[model samples]
Target: MTGTASARRSASPFSRAGVLGIVLVGFAAFIALLYFISAGDTGDRGNTGAAHASATGLNGYAGLVRLLENEQFDVTLSRTPSGLETTDLLILTPPLYSDPEDIAQILEARDYLGPTMVILPKWSASGPPNNLPAETADKFKDGWVALGSANTLQWTSELPAPFALTQKIETLEDDEVPQWSGLDQSGEVPTKTIAYAEQSALHDPLITDQSGHILALSVLGEEDSEYYNNAHWTVFVVEPDLVNNYGLSRQENAAAAIALVQQAGYEGDYSAVTFDLTLNGFGGAENLLTLAFRPPFLAATLCLILAMLSIAWRAFLRFGPAAIGGPEIAFGKKQLVSNGAGLIVRARRFGLLAAPYADLSARRLASRLGLIKHDAEAIDAALAVRLPEEEPYSLRADRLREARSSTEILRAAQALRELEGKLAK
Candidate 1:
């Protein structure tokens, strides 16, 4: 039984079928879960209607729509020109690339039912913010009164970059009057500086005059007396990088911008926010397409996929059989002793001691019987007669009991040996 157990312990699996079976089962479960999460319309889709963008529903906007919603702004997601009507203040985030048609639509509304905010992101040749043409650049300078440059940071504040580049948020001079009233934790307040620029990236004057009304000034724009006057308009243009999700989440730039928008006195606060590329643009083509085509569905699908993959990897891949080594042995001294005795008996070395022992026995018996030449038979007979069971062999026993030195002992033993043979015959 012990040997059987040892053999089994030493045995390896005959084939990999068991391992293969486990792999298949795990893979099946993984695929099933992946399909399930990605299949049906997941709730991760965009919300619909007025309730959707009303802080109640997060329908639209880029770079954290929830931030606006939390502040009781009528934040909505809209991509159509018609959807622009939903908000008085439209804060276009960075990463926006404008076509002529899009620019035309923006210009049409610039005069009256204006967007309170227009934020241009850092443009890169290869990414979400596509590089703008000189025409578009001119429009940005004349229209928004904002500019772009590398992000800046300092020991005193948390801006995204380390050096000053473009104007992000600008603070008005102490003597300048506010262009509008804004809310604070203390309720309604009056001030040109709703918040300080995360870094001092803003140009000397933040407002400019292009088409009569006070517009934002570009960071790189030339200084003109007309743009510096206080009564025209109040603009806070943050460094583009300072207002992104990574930066805004940490600093007060995002919150401050929201406040500024409300102070500008727009009707509703709804916007369809997307990067020039959608959220999916950050990953694979599938994700980009999904975000572009069906953003809500894609969002849900992604969530499910990630969840399923994590669970499957943990539950299936982490499990396996432990390895075993060689067979073992138990101990036994009694069995070893018996085996050694058997080996000695089989060697038949007892004859080597018997001949010498017989001669010695004859000599010792002779001495005991006072017969120096006595043999074994003589001693046997004497003892038997004295013991009273063998009188007939007494005389023979007496003669055979004589033995002298070692040679004599051997001779006497041989004579007794012959007598015993004659008696047996």
Candidate 2:
């Protein structure tokens, strides 16, 4: 049994199936750990509803995105606030329920970065209501409800200079469409009557209704206003309907929206156009791990990863072959006794074996003395008669039976061994 167990333990530790299973399990665990770490602290941002860049609903700007892409413009739907820090045109579409002060702060933060176009919210929309069945809701065509002036006014009143909208909605008459200020006329304009705005002193009205109320306005940067300064421009579109999905359904409306984007980029480059989604509550907050790998700490992160991989590689290459263990058990009865004693010592159970060993020693001493049918009391009497008077053998035998510790048991065992030697003589 000992030899077989030793051989099994000495066998190769590098079985192909075992190594493959360990590798697979380790890889799966690593992937799961990474996913758990990344998914831990993602903030509350739901990607749905109107004005969201990816939303395909009626009020979504997906149509505008497609149009820009078709025009060969590099359009990106920016989910994080950091994306606004670019030299491209940044378009912001805040929902009707959004706080105006928050919008103002975002604009102020991105003011000097590049040109921005703020599209005012016009519709309040949502998914089908809970009261409707899923099948019925899926077929529901009307999801957007137009917001009243009170709601629109509250949001507009919170914006900073050259960004507010008129409380009164100005409607364009049939056959009336706002034209780009410097661009020449081309085709029969779409008769889509939409809302327009009135501007402040800091704004230059670029597009106007027949009554001349500003439909679209341009706000130039302080440096851009001067002769040679190369600062980008900012634009404000009062009504979002003109460029949204419902508006862009007509070819003429699409043309007008494209012209607006071009106009915003007139000062510099129109190569890239980005729509902001941070304001709509998507990808607003970032985790600490993401920040660590971003800019200045990227080198440190790479070094850490490389160091870990190197350590793992070194450990893998360190194992050459299994070492041969010697014969399972040593020879001889003395060896067996030594092994038993060693086991008792390691187990710290000397006191437990003391009584049994003492009793067996007494029995053997009796048998050697030619005593027959000797009980423990008879053996004790015989030991008392034969042993020295000073150290009583019977008393020492009782002490061994009552021994409660390894030291006490060791002394009792030694006394028994001495008594046995005397009896053998």
Best by lDDT: 2
Candidate 1: stretches off by over 4 Å: 1-63, 94-97, 123-238, 266-425
- For this target, which candidate reaches the highest TM-score against the unseen true structure? 2
lDDT of each residue in 175-288, candidate 1, tens digit only: 754332123311111323222332233333343211111223222212343323321222334333223343344334455445445544432233333221121111112223
RMSD of each: 23.0, 8.9
lDDT of each: 0.39, 0.68
Q: Look at candidate 2 and tell me the lDDT of residue 265.
A: 80
C-alpha lDDT of residue 120 in model 2 = 75
Clashing pairs in 2: none
Clashes per candidate (backbone, < 3 Å)? 22, 0
Score residue 4 of candidate 2 by CA lDDT.
Answer: 67
